[model samples]
Every structure is written in C-alpha cells, then in structure tokens.
Target: MTRRRLLGLAALVAALLVATAAVVTTRLVADRPAAPSAGPSTTPPASPTPAPTTASPTPPPGADLKGPLNLLLVGVDTRVSIPGWEPHADAVLLLHVPAGLDRAYLFSLPRDLVVDIPAYPKARYPGGRTKLTHAMSYGSRVPGDKANPSTAQGYELLRATVSRYTGLRIDAGAVITFGGFDKLVDTLGGVDLYVDQRVASRHRRPDGTMRTLSGGGYIGPQMVYEKGTRHLTGWQALDYARQRYTAGGDYTRQRHQQQLLRALARKIVDEGTARDPQRVEQVVAALGRTLVYAGGGRQLIDFAYALGGVPADRLTLVVLPGAGVSSGGAYRGEQLKPLGRDFLTALRGGRVDAFLTAHPSLRVKN
Candidate 1:
C-alpha cells in the first residue's frame, strides 16, 4: 500500500521538524514559483539573524543547550489579502519541543478563537477582545503606516498574543504564504497523506467559481478529497488544508495541516534536502524571501538536523478542547473551558505528557 494509506499517529516525532526547524506563516501573491533551476537569490531580506557559514559548529551530544523550546507558527491569508484585502492569521499552531528534542507536541489554535489582545500602537482597536487571527493585522493597520502588516512589528504582536494564551515563552516564528507553501510542496515533488474520512472544500474552483449550496454555504462542486491515501501537489494540499466544511469542521482542517506538515518534513528528510549545500541555499533563499522569520536560519538548520531521526509515531497532535458558539449573532467563535486552562498549567509545569495521558481524547487520533 502507499505511504499515505499506511500513515497514522504512528511516529510523528520527526514531524516536529516543521515547527522547530522554522515556525512558518504566509500567502503572498508576488511569490511566484522560482524556476526549477533557480539558485539562491541574493541574500533573502534581513533574516532573523545572519546566515551561518558552511563551517558553523554543530551541537555536541551532551552540549548544554536551552531547555524546552516554544515556537508560534502563524499562517496568514496573504494570497487573498493583497492590495485591498485585509490580512488575518488563518492558522496558529503552538509548537513545543522539549529539551530532549526526541518528540514534539503541536497545539492548533483556531483562527476564530476569541481572546483579549493587549493594546499596541497602530492596532485598529487599542486593547479589546477580538478573534485571535486579527492580532497580526491590527498591529500594522494604522493609517499612513508604511510597514508591511505581516512583517516585524506585526509578528511581534502575534507572538505576544500567542505567548499570552499558551503561557509559553515563544522564542521564534516563521510566516509562509499559501502561494509559498504551494510552491514549496511542488518543489519537494508532492506529499502523500491519509484521510480518515472524505473531505470537501468551500474554496473557489480552478475557474474561480464556488458552487453555492443550500443555506448559503458554498463548496467545491465535487468533493475535494475522498477517504484513503492521496498524493497532493502544492495547490491541492492548500485546498485540502482549507476544507473546514467537512464532518469535523475546523478541527478536520487542523488535523490535515498537521498531516501535511509531517509529510513535507518527511520528504525533506528522505530527500536529504538539508545535506545538499545548493539545495539548502535555495531553500533558505526561498523561505527567507517568501516567509518571515523571527529566528535565524542557522538555528532552524541545527534543529532540523537534531530532530531528523525522530519517527512519525513519536509526534503528537494536541487540539485545545473547545466548542463553537455564535457571538453577537454574527461571528462564530470557539471557547475552550477547563481543558484550555488546565492545558496551560500543564505546559507551564512542563508536564504535557501527563496532561495528554490524562486526557487522551484531545489527541488527534487520525
């Protein structure tokens, strides 16, 4: 059988590479696909830190490195927000890599999650309750501000907001656009994934058409994906990741994102992308150009090498338990109760395994 068909929560530890290597977010339209032969472009915009040289030191087996690492992964709707569109954080994932770096835990924060945002200069609403996704945009939306809303200042606000919610110190982050993600997938050839159930998307068709359904809901005319093992290109992967209308709703999309996240990391490891100097340079350039990074590329490479051996079965996906509620009779929101509060406490205490053991239901089973 294909890898996707055989895939499950078997060994997800290697999957931690996606977040630990470089927590990514974005959706830029100008992010055209680099030519197949394209080499690294002139130094990518100012990176989180200077790029490392070929002779950079590697961590020794027992080196005294920092303890558990917490990173915030922000995926934005930059593709649909060019020019006149409003940018928002579509996917927010909290990645925790323990000091051991043997396994990883990923927490998906729903975009529609309601939370209190601290006041910041240029924020549309100075300190008020709003959707978690709006924090990034609000940080750079001031009139006459020339800064890009998804860059430096904007991401800091997002990091702060996420840190507040998770109670974990977020040290680094990365933002990748839908377009960049698509191209990256294509660059890796394609990814294979298993679906627990059939999935349909509400995204527009290739011809830019969305079939309207009864009750005013819109989805692809044909089912976007069927249950079983499936090979997905960049575009198809994005569509699959955005299928919130499926049986599990937004929860399903979060699971799919993790699935894709692991699949991509697997492809990178299997292909030895990091070991290849030219390929590494190319990837660094593309990511630096298309995604925003809060940490240096060297740190990302170091973590990737350290965690490359982890098996997929070791990776655990955790979704904060919550329920959907209609707020103000207009916007839909998700509220996590005891589970949310309790999870943060576990995180603060560095006892996620205990927490997960106690509450297995929150674990993503697929």
Candidate 2:
C-alpha cells in the first residue's frame, strides 16, 4: 500500500477502534433475536479519573509470580436499559495473560458450545439446569417471586465453572454488558473489521413487506461482508461481533470479538490515543462503571502493561473445541454444548505458565 493509502487506512482503523469502545450504547433493534442478558439496568457512566502518562499500571503487590494469569473475559448480550436482561452469552474469551510483556493467548469459548451450568439452582429447573447461557437467563427472568437476578451471581458462577471446567486457575474476571460494550467501542473511535460473510437478518416486522436490516435483503446490516478491510461504526461492529447466525456460527463470532478487541487496542496505541489523558480517563471510568471486575483494577492494568510488551505475532488465539446444537428448554428453546478437553489441554500444554515464569518483573501476587 502507498504511504498515503497506508496512512489513510491507519487513520480509518484508528477511528474505528475508538468507535468500538464508545459504541456500547444503542437501542436493541430486536429484543427476541438477542441471547438473554446477564443483567438489566443501564450501567451508569463511571466517574473519570486522571490518566497516567507514565508506563502502564504496575501489577498488584506480590501478585503470584507464577505462570500465566487467566483472565476470564465475558461478553453480556443484554440491552443495558432493562435491568437484569437475561441474554445468553454470545461470546466468551479466556485471556491467558503472560507474567511480563509477551503477548497473551486468547481462548474463545463458543456461547452455543454449551457446557454444564455449574451450581444452577436445582429448585427451579427441578432437573438441575439448562444451557450454560441460560444460567443468566434463568437467574434473571425467573420472576422475582420465584428467583432473584443472576447478574453478579452468574458472573461468579461462570468464573468458578470455567476454572473447574478448564482446570486453570483464573486470576481475574471482567464482564462488560452490551451498553458498556458499545461505549467502549465508541471510545476507541471505531473498529475496522473484515466481515467474513454476508450477515442477513430481516425475519419479520409489522409491515406487510418482509423487513430486514436498515440496508437491504434480510434488512438491517450487510450480512455478506466483502472479505476485505472495512470501517465499521459502533452498531455495525457490534452487529458483526455479536451476530452468530452465520454458517460458521459461534466459533466465527467468538473469534471476531477477540480480533476486534485486539484490533481496537492496537489501533488505539498506534494512533497514540491511549496517551491522551481524556481518552484514558474515559476508558478507566467506563471500565469502572459498566464493567464488573472480580479482582483489583490496578492489577488488571498491570496485566495490560505486561501484555502490552508482547509482539502481536506471538499472540495465540485458542478456542475450546466444541460445537453448538439446539437443546430442549421450557420458556424459550436453548442452544448448548460441552466444554471439551481440548480447551483444558490447550491451557495445560500451551506453555502459558512457563512463558509467564520467564518474565519476573511483571509477576505480582495479592
């Protein structure tokens, strides 16, 4: 690419990156189509903090100098305005954070690729449980009379369950809802992602004519994305990242989220956006407000600093190998799958811990 073209592309990419973070809020086009939400309620915007221009945050004091730290990254699919919206998790990412600087590995968990919902309330289902995604759905929509909301509890269970299911000690967990997610996207400007396939949507509407996305066939967004670089607004990016109805399904969607998040990070850093105090403050505030961090935020920053050291090429992406299939459910039919051995084996054999050991300064135990 010519220098001019490259610069333009980079600028476009940077804008898209910022857009990804800021675009966390958009009215849900269709309520039924989305997976149940982990919680309802619009997350209040976090109060801004002064951005630090110095090197990234120092890890928490005495963080386990052990090997790689497992970060349970979760994506909640609910519309934020409705508190405790129980949407099935459309995406799950397990970030294998190395001790120091080396790039971390990202393991994508297919949402439909169901696994047992650990600690599901037996009283309600009688049978014990349904799809893993329903773990939140059941927690929320079960009626206040029958059961309490599962947003916080669901997150806790997911972390515990994933660790047990995968046999990796997760150091921390961070979850961002659809609204916060949109904001984060916008904060990053916008994200440039290659649509792997045409995303078709128009299933129905009150209009006599069959309705689709705002654009054309199937309606809303372009389902069949040309296989090349393209700028995606917050809505478009979310649609691309969240939509899993493609022929490839959850696997594709999971990878797409990881890619876009990573891309957003890269573009931001490359564009010097992270150095901007206002932008940094927005990010930290956003995280604090919409995101729930099971552990310390300072530690998470330190983890980011350590991850920032790695070359992108060395970064590995792994998915717990599995498939999705429709499972029987009571209120709404659910889709589910098993968390296979491959996921565990990948963590066990991936030298993740070993890599972390190689770096000393980054290790911190609390």
Candidate 3:
C-alpha cells in the first residue's frame, strides 16, 4: 500500500481495536479460525460459534472504568494475503486510556516526522536519522540482504521510535492489515462519519485510469464528501480516511482519521453491536484476521469491557504538537516543540488533563 493509504488503515485498525473492547465478551465463542501451530500467520482464525449462552444483564451506559491503559496502535501497510511480508507502518497512534476509563486520548504522530532510528546489526544506517514511517520498512526486512526480520522486530523499531519521540512507552500494540479493516467495517454494516471539509479521493477508476474533473486534471477516485454528516461503507470509509490533497494535508487527514474512529465507536454502541453475541463473534473473527496483537487477546478484551459503556463524546483526539516544514527539496517533516515535551511530561506524571489544559490548541473535535 502507498503511504497515505496505509495511514488510512491505521485509523481503521484503531477503530477495530477499540471496538473489540466494546463488543467482545468471554461468553462469545471463538468462532474464528485458529492460528497455524508452528508459526504466526496473518490470517484470522474462523472457529464456529457455539449455541447462545444465557442472556446477561446489560451494564449501565457511561460506566466509569478503573486504571490506565496504553496501546501502540500501528497500521501495517501490507496485503493480508501476502503473509510474512514486512510492510511499513503507514499510521501510528498512541491510544491512552487514563486512570478513569470514562475517557480516551488518541495521539497521532505524523508519518513524516523525522527521528533517529537505532542501529540493528547488519542493517542500513546501523542507526541514522530518517522519517518515522521508514522505521517499520527498515525493521520489517533486510531487503536485498535476504535476512528477513520478524514482524515483532519491525514493531520494536516502531515502538522505540515512538517512545523516543513522545517519551511514552507502548504497553501493548496491534498491527492491523487492510484486509482485516475491510472485513470489520463490512461486518459492522457501516459507520456514521461527520466530514470536517469536502473530500475528493485519488483512487483509480475501474478502467485502470485516474479520475478527473470537468475542469481537466485527474480527480483520482470519486469518493467525494461534503462538510456534513453521512454514513460510509467499509470501502467508502477507507477512501475517505486516505484523503490528503487538501489545504490541511496530513493534518486534515489525521483529524478525519480520528473522526472515523469516533464514528465507528458510536455505531458499534448505538447500533447495539455489542449486545448481539453472533454479531460480536463475527466482528471478533474479522478482527482476528487483521490484528497482529502485541498483548494477547484476553488483556485487550478486559480493557475493552471496562470502557465499552463509554460513548463517543468522552473520547478526545489530539495530534502531537508540531508544525510541518520542508527538509530540503521535496522531503517534508514536522518540527515538534515545547508542546510535545510538555505533553509528554504531563503524560508521564499521569496528568494528561493538565497537558490538554495547557495546550488547548492541540485538541480536535471528536
């Protein structure tokens, strides 16, 4: 996948990860297929769902959760069909569940933000500066050297890069593929999206040609959206999240990604996807296919359960504090500042609310 498309998938993965916490229950059967005994596979298991168990009492909505959680949400830019291929991390999000689970903080890192990659034995640069996104590619494979790196190695590089940049460690993480993203959205039926601005996509046409406007230049794919609320299918949502050609560029893209997550969460809860065992099973199955979980399933499930009652309004979205600048010619990077340092300080001290208060400009609409 191209870098931008991969970023879109990152948003999708976050939605799925969060949704799992909302929908999965212990009583829910592990209907998805099992993993290969010998090695890790990108494919999600498909165990059959058993008969329904006794109905349980519904928890009160907006229930507050206990303890804090940290997750490194990474969108892997590789085809699910092609297992074992190390894809670059197109999108990286730091999903933080604070001491009170009533709210969430999703912090985004621009892919072009430059950072120093640590030296890996026999690897390029053995440690040198590069775009944050490249850390995944470099760690994913040895390339022409034929010494392939495991998916975990790629994540380690990414985790280290994020920690170095943001001063927060990833307690757990998951790598979601494009295929898994498509499946989860389709299973959810669709999500409601509130567009901040009009978006015109750059996806190719069915004729293998680029879409164009009446004024002449190519318009790419025609998944256009006005600045209003609308429902998006799995494909439409992905295309919408991938848009980056507007005036806001990556910043706008990140905002839309955050919106997509909120929209998906609302749909999952409002539409009652969490209460239906069969549906939850299907959703979990779809997630299994796409998720390369860093923390095992049980912990994520427990985390999700704690916060499932929380609604979209409680979730907060914030981009890492920075301004975009050119590196020389065409290369671009985000120059982060004292805001980043301050935010990290607050985060480490378990005072995210203080950080947000100090940097009101960093907050975005949910």
- Model 1, runs deviating above 4 Å: 1-64, 122-125, 146-148, 206-220, 281-288, 296-313, 327-332
Worst 10 residues of 1 by lDDT: 23-32
TM-score order, best first, reads 1, 3, 2
lDDT of 2 by residue, 264-302 (tens): 655654675543556656655664555655653433333
Model 3 lDDT tens row, 224-281: 6778888777777777776778768877887777777767766665566655678877
Q: Evaluate all candidate structures by whole-model CA lDDT and list the values in order.
A: 0.63, 0.51, 0.65
- Model 3: which ten-residue window has the lowest total lDDT? 1-10
Query: What C-alpha RMSD separates each model from the true structure?
Result: 10.5, 14.3, 11.3
lDDT by residue (36-90, candidate 1, tens digit) is: 4457666565776877778955443223335586766767776454563446778
TM-score of 1: 0.75
As a whole number from 0 to 100, the lDDT of residue 172 in candidate 2 is 63
Best candidate (score: lDDT): 3
Q: Please report the TM-score between candidate 2 and the true structure.
A: 0.64
Better of 1 and 2 by TM-score: 1
TM-scores of the models, in the order given: 0.75, 0.64, 0.74
